[model samples]
Target: MALPDRYTGDDFYCDVAIPSAAQLDVVHDDELVLAYHHTRPFWATHLVVVPKRHIDSFTSVTECDEADVRQLFAVVQRLAREVTEREGAAAVLTNLGRYQDSKHLHVHVHSGPQRDHT
Candidate 1:
């Protein structure tokens, strides 16, 4: 899939990626959440799980985001389990503050050997 000339991660999930999820290798999709293979994978098996709605970041979650938060973690757990079962090991992770490249909340479910960085 062709990407923008500049791969800026800032809010890419909500602004760009989610809208084009159908074209991606989607793992899971529903009204509340979407999970798909990463466009630029860091591991042999790398998947991204995110809320369908716009939530700035985990730290920025508000009371109104309760349902979305629950759904997000539930999806992450399921995807992590699937990856672990298939690869014998898996990691579930989310970034924050400076670590978070994207402004939107997202979790990564990944396993297997690490790939070379681009």
Candidate 2:
């Protein structure tokens, strides 16, 4: 789960217009993608990779989403390399449907032993 919803009940990605780009601690930003530090991190090292355009979840990804999805993964690949090189290992993951707290499609790049986030 993320912070108490500070905005209207909308999928985070779709509301990009609400958060000025300057407010986002963006790592990678382009026409199709955005990668940044997770606002709520579960692991010692965590980063979030998401598309600037809304894509719901992996289940909602379609052939039309191919280019954007590939762009998303490209960001993930670069960040994962940086994380693993720095920490010795890394984990890249994403959730779907009930498993995904936010409806927007995103990937988590993390490192370190798991801990009780709560």
Question: Which of the numbered candidates is closest to the native, going by highest TM-score?
Answer: 1
Question: Worst ten-residue run, lDDT, model 2?
Answer: 1-10
Q: Which lDDT tens digits does candidate 2 get at residues 17-110?
A: 2255566667888999888777667888888888887888988999999999999998999999999999999999999867887788999999
List candidate 1 segments past 4 Å from native: 1-5
Q: How big is the positional error of residue 51 in model 1, measured in Å on the Cα after superposition?
A: 0.6
lDDT of 1 by residue, 77-118 (tens): 888888888889999888999999989899999998889986
Look at candidate 1 and tell me the lDDT of residue 58: 85
- List candidate 2 segments past 4 Å from native: 1-10, 16-18, 114-118
> How big is the RMSD of model 1?
1.7
lDDT for model 2 comes to: 0.81
